[model samples]
Target: MTQATAADAATFAVAVPALGPDVRCHVLQPGRPPLFIEPAGERLLDRAQFRQWSRTVRPALDALILEHGGIVLRGFPTAGTEDFADFIEQFPAFDGGYAGGRAPRETISGRVMEATRLSASVRLAVHSEMAYRRDYPRRIAFFSRKTAEVGGETLITDVRHLAERMDPELAGRLATLGSRTAINFGPRRDADDASYAHMDERGWNQSFHTEDPAEVNRLCAERGLEPVWHEDGSLTVLNALEPFVVHPQTGRKLYRSILHMLPQVENPEQDLERRKRQKYPTGATLGNGERLTDAERAHIDQLCDQTTYSWPWRDGDVMVLDNLQVWHGRNPYQGTRDVQVALLD
Candidate 1:
């Protein structure tokens, strides 16, 4: 899709009078994703004013995210985690919480987390947050505390666009067969240990935030995951997920798979050797027990890239997204890049 017209992007401003005459809104690039909103001048809103503004625009903000997939609030006076948490508190928290989340992140405060602890060299794949889970957040917000010197743009893509671009045959197969995702959690290895071979690796105890196996199993059951125990105290959870879904509010069909986030096979034929050689701790297979070929994956990646949009992070820049409609990822970067995130239902 082409970039939306200025009038299309200004709908939020028309609806939310509290945006003030000094604030400006526009699209980022070839597309209108993450509609950019910032102060038109040097005048910045204080914490109190920012909170009040957020409260007044909450209804419009929801509509904007649903329409644009994401939005970035730049030039806001956000100093630290407190300011970020305060801004997020204005929105309803996801009551289900992030108990079974797979990201290797640290919780900085209430409903706030350090985005990820992965190496800066690792480029994250674009996928909806927690799409594999039975109970996933409907919305997610991100905050950038420090911008990377070289790269590290938070990538986003509209799922509707991606679904539209997908091959009809593959899309139909996915819709009919769905997909099965599995995550393996071995005993926690030292972060610096060379044996740390898997992405986002964590012990089952750490993953479920509990010491008891029964508690972990209970959590898995509640989250629609089937847990399997290994002899070495490792745990593997399996879940079957629909690759396509209808948006609850919009009634639009969305491509909701996380195939890009997992290890993929290069060969079209699924064999025992390929399965054994899979290196990632997490992987997915077609619901019919077939693996997706790397060629097919490349096509999907291209579709995502064709619609993907990103912007360099600035200090205190906040991005809010409709998780069901948008897919998010990261680009490999150099230097220190600090980003925080919050999830909401």
Candidate 2:
């Protein structure tokens, strides 16, 4: 039950590309890229073998992940949600639930939930999960239940790397302002779910998992969110967030929510403009409530674009990410893709 380890930290560290600051995607394969460990003889890991891996390699796996920021566990047997949950048990999860959740997710089993219900055509902007909320998960994990025929590859960026490369003034402003955003949830369902879609809007009751308003207020207060009840029987949540968060592991400030709240008007189309009228449309601002300048936005876009890299999804591949160090997003695709997600506090 011996698992492999890198000879030195330099080789194991994610290498930055020579041509550009961007780190190229690591397309994992069988019996290659020493990072992809094949336990149980290059096949799906069996229960007993996985147990041994848990006992022996857990510390090394965590140490490697700490140095690498993220790790992919493939060639491991995960036929369904239960198996995936069992595999996840080896790595200790952070405490807390999805208090300030985004996306339409159905909890399959244990903590495993659907990644997002956003439309297939939508081009997702990269951002850390629950970045705008007061409390966020330290680790984000994804399990690929299905792989698309074409496209549908997830784009991930190492915020740890991007932090040093970002423009200093912008980073300073974000550090001071943190960032603030507001979301207004109307009583009725969002008629337009696709365009400007932020998260699953099943109604406040379902989101809070309670029908009582008093209890809902209590929960909202705990999360540092302001709950405003509209006359039309709708609720609006205003959240004050910091754009740059210090990584728990590295303690370096990393840019966050830039993509989630980049308040640019892409088109003058009716739908896009209509979403603008709503209070809850995703947006970003300085801690002082001043808007980010044009130059700052452009610089952020350049950095974000350069840092993004994607790889095709393979069935049954699971990825564990340090939420504070990496940002994840969805890319448009054809055919079908089924990815289940579970965020551990």
Q: TM-scores across all candidates?
A: 0.87, 0.81
- Candidate 2: clashing residue pairs, number: 3
Q: How many backbone clashes does candidate 1 have?
A: 0
For candidate 1, the lDDT comes to: 0.75
C-alpha lDDT of all candidate models, in order: 0.75, 0.64
lDDT of 2 by residue, 137-191 (tens): 7878888989888888877776675767877776776776677776544464433
For residues 250-316, what per-residue lDDT tens digits would candidate 1 score against the true structure? 8888888876545322232442343464342367778887877888888898888887877667999
Which numbered prediction scores highest in lDDT against the true structure?
1
